[model samples]
Target: MNLELTASNVYKSYNGNQVIRDCSYSFDMCDIYILTGPNGSGKSTFLRICALLENPDRGEIEYSSEQRVLKKDLELRRRITLVLPRVGVFNASVYRNISYGLAIRGIKGGDFREKVNRMIEFVGLRNKKDQNALTLSSGETQRLGIARALIIEPGILFLDEPTTSVDQANTGIIEDIILKMKEEHKTTVVVATHDKDQAKRLGDKVLMMNDGKIIPT
Candidate 1:
């Protein structure tokens, strides 16, 4: 089912310092929204809030469909996923790591194996499917993280600095995978990045963040 995420008057603070200031936005289904800003501009924090991984100090984060709003329960949470800047990997094989998400959800069988294999190949990690995930280079690990997140087929994908540790080649490949998600899967993707060029290349709409507030781009 398609879901829309809306945030209103969001405010977040850590200690005496406020990180987010009255941020408000609506994320539509099947469109790519780029949240661009400098390193400490609260882009990643905003993404976490939108993904419901973090609660805002004062705001409303409503997940609703055209029919009605859904509760902020486990079911709603399962429909979204987030990938951080530094992707944590397991000591297990690439295949195993990619299959972990489905396994935890009690999903296994021929269908599960097929999805795992497809995702491994999708991120250009077919050759390394059997390699240990922890041994993967920075670029490959990032690809693995993307594959892991995509395997679950989250309705809304929040990618925070997906290419930060990746090289130029892998960066292009990751970008292509994201674009393909938009073109083929109709996943609602929100990416946090500091690169304006990348935002231009990938975003259906670009929103700038500064001083913990979203500015129109």
Candidate 2:
């Protein structure tokens, strides 16, 4: 199904200070959108609202297909995943960290093992499958976080500064995986980043924001 997400007249504030000022944008399925801006530009705040991680103070978020609106409920949320700027890992083995989501979702047995193994290899952590997640380097932890999110196969993926702390080598790997996701799973990806080059490489359409407003690109 072709999914569409729309945000209208979105506004958010913190302590009487507005951050996202009447921001509005729409995105369709299977496309990569890069929200690029300097720090405090409200890119991350906008992404968080769209990803349903944070609610907009005054706005409406609508999900639709074939011009029909779908209720924004738990089921809709299940189709979306967000990876924050700071990577969070379980204090467990790499294999366990990768498999935890599947397990919670009632996936088990051979199917579970196969999916977990595939993700570990896909993220280049096959050799560290049994290693503790906390012991992994920053790059490795970020990869693991991506793997964990991707294993669930969300229809929409939100990444906030995914390559912020990653090194040059791992940055390439992360970008590759994101492209692969768009091609194979048709995931709609929304990324908030500060790097213009990275945005050009991954974004089908790039939106520039400054001081809580999107500038014309």
Candidate 3:
């Protein structure tokens, strides 16, 4: 089932200062999209609205599958995941951090252990599986965040400047993981970035933004 997410005439403002202005776009399932722009251009805000992390001050966001509209609810939100620029991790072990979501959803025992272990290895953190998440470097922490987000197999993934604080080596790894998710899991990806090279490398389609509006590429 191919899902589609659409936003129409979206507008957002903070402290009475307009951030996103009349933005509209549609995203289809299993494709990678890049939202590129400069600082304060509203890329993150726009992505948040689409990911259902924030509501638009004006306009509507709709989800549909096979041309039939679906309700926007907790279930729908569960299918979409967002990874912010700053990496957030639990104070516990890397194993616990990645397994938290799975455990919440009732996965346990051998099934739970397998999933957690696989994800840890996939993110190149197997050697650090028992290490405290807070002790990880920026790159390792970012990888952990990606592993956590992907463990649940979200239908749509929103990455807001995910590599902004990452080193070049880790940036390449993150980019590869993003591509791998799209190709293997068929997870629809929406990435907001300022790096033109990264956009070209990973984006199936690019949407350029400026001053809270999407500009023609």
Strongest candidate by TM-score: 1
- Model 1: residues with Cα > 4 Å off, grouped in runs: none
Q: Write the per-residue lDDT of candidate 3 for residues 86-178, one digit (tens) a residue.
A: 867889999999998888788889988988898898889999999999999898888899899989888788888989878999999999999
Name model 2 segments beyond 4 Å from true: none
Could you give the candidate ranking by lDDT, starting with the highest?
1, 3, 2
lDDT of each: 0.91, 0.88, 0.89
Displacement of the residue 119 alpha carbon in candidate 2, Å? 1.4
For residues 1-217, what per-residue lDDT tens digits would candidate 2 score against the true structure? Answer: 5468998889999999899998878888899999899999999888888878889999888888788898888878877788888878888999999988798789989989999999998889999999999999878888888889889888788898999988999899999988988998788888889999999999998999888877648
Model 2 clashing residue pairs (backbone): none
Clashing pairs in 1: none
TM-score between candidate 3 and the true structure = 0.96
- Cα deviation of 62, candidate 2, in Å: 1.2
